[model samples]
Target: MDILKSLGHPEELINLFKFKIGGCRTIMPKLDYESMSESLRTCYQYLNQTSRSFAAVIQALDGELRHAVCIFYLVLRALDTVEDDMSIPLDRKVPMLNDFHTYLYQDEWCFTESQEKDRKVLEDFPTISLEFRNLAREYRDVISDICHRMGVGMAEFLEKKVGSMKEWDQYCHYVAGLVGIGLSQLFSASQLEDPEVGQDTALANSMGLFLQKTNIIRDYLEDTQQGRAFWPKEAWSQFAGRLEDLAHPDKLELALSCLNLLVTDALRHVPDVIAYLSRLQNQSVFNFCAIPQVMAIATLSSCYNNPMVFQGVVKIRKGQAVTLMMEATNMRAVHTIISQYSQEILQKVSVSDPSREKTLHTLALIREKSTLSQSSLQSRTHHLSPMYLSAAMLLAALSWQYLNTTAVQTQGTGDMQG
Candidate 1:
């Protein structure tokens, strides 16, 4: 009831209604998750404090779907942390992860040793306290598979063995593309939509690519400091002249010019998110889709003016995040709002520079792609290459909003100067 009140009285402009757009149907066939030995109340408590939306979602879901999703998120978060930890030695860590995957599928293996073996940071996991250890264990296999694919890709990249930009895109697909697949499986299994859900897995993959690419771009400083470069050497050299010299103040202008194009490229997927949201036929799915898209928009807004986003943590204010959530309560408003904000961002860097005409030209292509994408939401031919996917998606999403809003002119608009 508290969640219902929060849902009904959401603080934003858009979240006023809830409905199923597609003809989705429920598919939860299992419910033995009730027998889990873990202190679920404690898990629920931790989740509420950390993620109110997730908590709301858990409360809203049926018993079977709730437990499965909770476990899935928990497992994925653990794997993601492992991937992000620069302090961990790859020699010992990668193998352990490989073994963790095997352990998940092989029930005879013990996870009790896992607690002792993992770094102190992961020692507090509730893996040992669950009856559905088997499920977590299976998901461990999922993590392992993802890692294996990413490991091979990263290895080739670092070794300079990747032959082309095509390969680079494939690498992003291995690590982040699979998240889309995993999410789609979860959506289908939850049966929270019309039986004939029109969800497009390709768009979901693009959405994930947009998120991951954003991280790579924003972490330019951090990744470089750690001796890990996710940006393709081909792009850095071809566009900006040198891969390692991106830190030089002289290159900043050209780099940022090139970077803006990448951001634009990433934005191309905004329509994909919109399309996906429009396809969802249930409340839980709608919330899941809406929250991430809102967060993505907010992240873009926070990163817009802050060049230091490359150097360190960049985040939206909690108050602003809550505002986005409140607004997201209305589906129509969410689309309109994101479109507007995204447009404002594109307008910031739309001007052409003579010195970096080549860079600007690249962005021009991105702008064109965005325009074309806006013209047809169903076309895959407009997809940007992988390394630039985040930048492209960001710019595209923003540009789409900008272009869409530009179609109408306000007559006799009186300006109120504050």
Candidate 2:
């Protein structure tokens, strides 16, 4: 069904087929689970459980850096779970957020009382904190520092709503930008990348901001429906009476205007993203960083000037995501992906839209930074005919079915032998 939805995107369809049949190992290699320590293995389990989008890239990270990042992610995931659970009293939540860093040093500090779905991390904090303590001092220092700052930042925001653009950036910086900086520091600490990758805070912050903003833009309905709001009041108030009012059927024009304005704000970070990716030296680290940024741009392209954002979810197709995962391994491929999506957004720009000029200007800067030659800009699927795409999708579906049946039969045979 997903393949059928992506019939117009033949390259993505092919990439999707390749990914399903184990070609993804070439792009995203997994760590050996059985060889891991009990605590480390548990951390990976929580990573997979908490983040569908990030677990693969986190696993694909090279060497000890992979373990460090896995723990870092789990720590933040636990922190975010605490912040996100509205049922937690403000007094308890505020202190926990402020002192989340200190909890890393405690040997038995698990909190099983939380009601969030990913609360297992909090429920089993001792295991995670034990692993955190086992990390090398440099890696531990970076993770703990980011956790402390991010905790403090999360606490501060709990008392208020996002009122201004600057406040929005501050909030994203605390939650996400700090993750980028910490990961860069981990990469450098592992001797896989240069010190400047961690030291250049501005670029790292921008890397985080780009992904965070894209998520905030795309999740408008889900966030608002959940009684959470991340969009700045300063921007949304310009379009309607209240932020929630943008979702009303009668206010779609205003809703679209507000969405475009936020999308433009997100685009302003692309130049910084390009610069940040350019500085990456390790192939694994680059893939880890680049794939998400490209996916963010592709998502923004889908959401730009589109009303689906207000009505429901807006996500890039799974095939498109697989294509990005396969192709975004090198700087040149990343540039092409960013350039292609930038052009998609440009094509959707409406002249009467309030953010049209700013949108065009930001996109122009992105093109100038990320654009390659005209030949490189051509679509990968341009040569495929409708007949070929249809045949390919059919073959992929049949192949998947055969593989699944064979696996099930093999498992049955093993069970009978046992």
Candidate 3:
């Protein structure tokens, strides 16, 4: 079924196929880390193994911040491993979450019960911890503080269901919003960006909230199948007998209504995201932040009022992601992308839809706030002809796979680098 869907919809295959082969090859540093300490080398190896998208961005960063950010990401990934492992007993998990930051200092702490995808990060955490300890005191303090706060937050919600809009925001803040705050602190500490640039905690929180909400909305099917639910009862309960009821084939309309409402609620964060992006000073930092924001808005656009949220994954095309990544180098580019996707969502919201009024109002705010001039909007719209777009995409996917393979060969690839 998935393969057929991929064939009929080549945009879906393009990213997966490319990511598997050569998604971020151009930005990656050369393979030889001979100058790095053994611990740093192992940590970088582990980071490359664990997260391709993040590894790509971290490597793109300038100087010491790159290493600091890499270690920071690994430490959090280790803490998140402990938090995300549902199979562990509550007694074990809760304490682990509460003390995860301290574990980064211990250098011997390791958790073996993480899900398979993340298990290596848990087992090899000592390498990450070693690197974490070597970081400058300012960087170490910020990473440790964020990990401590996030761990406690995850522990608080482990046994409770998210029941309201407020709870949803709190949960997201714990897991993701804090990440935004921590990164701001790191960027400021690195001296690469102005300290004042990271001070807007509310906007940083909104940036993280926007991404987290979009993921929750996109992963409805996967989360439900796995017995996890992050969408608050406040919205879903109004549309269905139960949250999982929307997943049943029989409740397609109600499911889409609920999905659209969630998307609409998530849109309230857009302006704040724009405000946050506008403060960034570093080009790499801007790219790192802007790509994800652009991707989130693009995903929301595709998922808005679309029934696929209940069916399977709904994603932006690889072509679209590459375009955004290449062109979204400034606030103006970011605004244009947001304007485009917001328009896409507004066009799709129907008058009869339950959330149409809320959706329209939210999108109008986005359109009004975007700084995209009419001339820029006219020059930016790029789409291939549908008839041969997929065929061309298939060839592009194959080319990326070949590029990824040959790039690894030339660069001395790390284990599980993809």
Most accurate candidate by TM-score: 2
Per-residue CA lDDT of model 3 for 249-333, tens digit only, reads 8898888888898999899999988988888888888877887888899999989888888888887655556556656778988
Q: Which stretches of candidate 1 lie over 4 Å from their true place?
A: 1-62, 85-94, 97-99, 106-168, 194-199, 239-244, 302-306, 353-418
Q: Model 1, clash count?
A: 36
Clashing pairs in 2: none
TM-score for each of the candidates: 0.64, 0.95, 0.88
Kindly indicate the candidate among 1 and 3 with the higher lDDT: 3
Better of 2 and 3 by lDDT: 2
- Which regions in candidate 3 have their CA more than 4 angstroms from the true location? 1-32, 381-418
Shift of residue 293 alpha carbon in model 2, Å = 0.6
Over 242-324, each residue of candidate 2 has an lDDT whose tens digit, in order, gives 89999999999999999999999999999999999998889999999999999999999999989999888898888788889
Candidate 3 structure lDDT: 0.81
Task: For candidate 1, write residues 320-417 as lDDT tens digits.
Answer: 45445545544665665565456556556535633234334533543443333343333312344655554544443454344334533534211111
Q: Give the candidate number with the greatest lDDT.
A: 2
Worst 10 residues of 3 by lDDT: 1-10
TM-score, cand. 1: 0.64
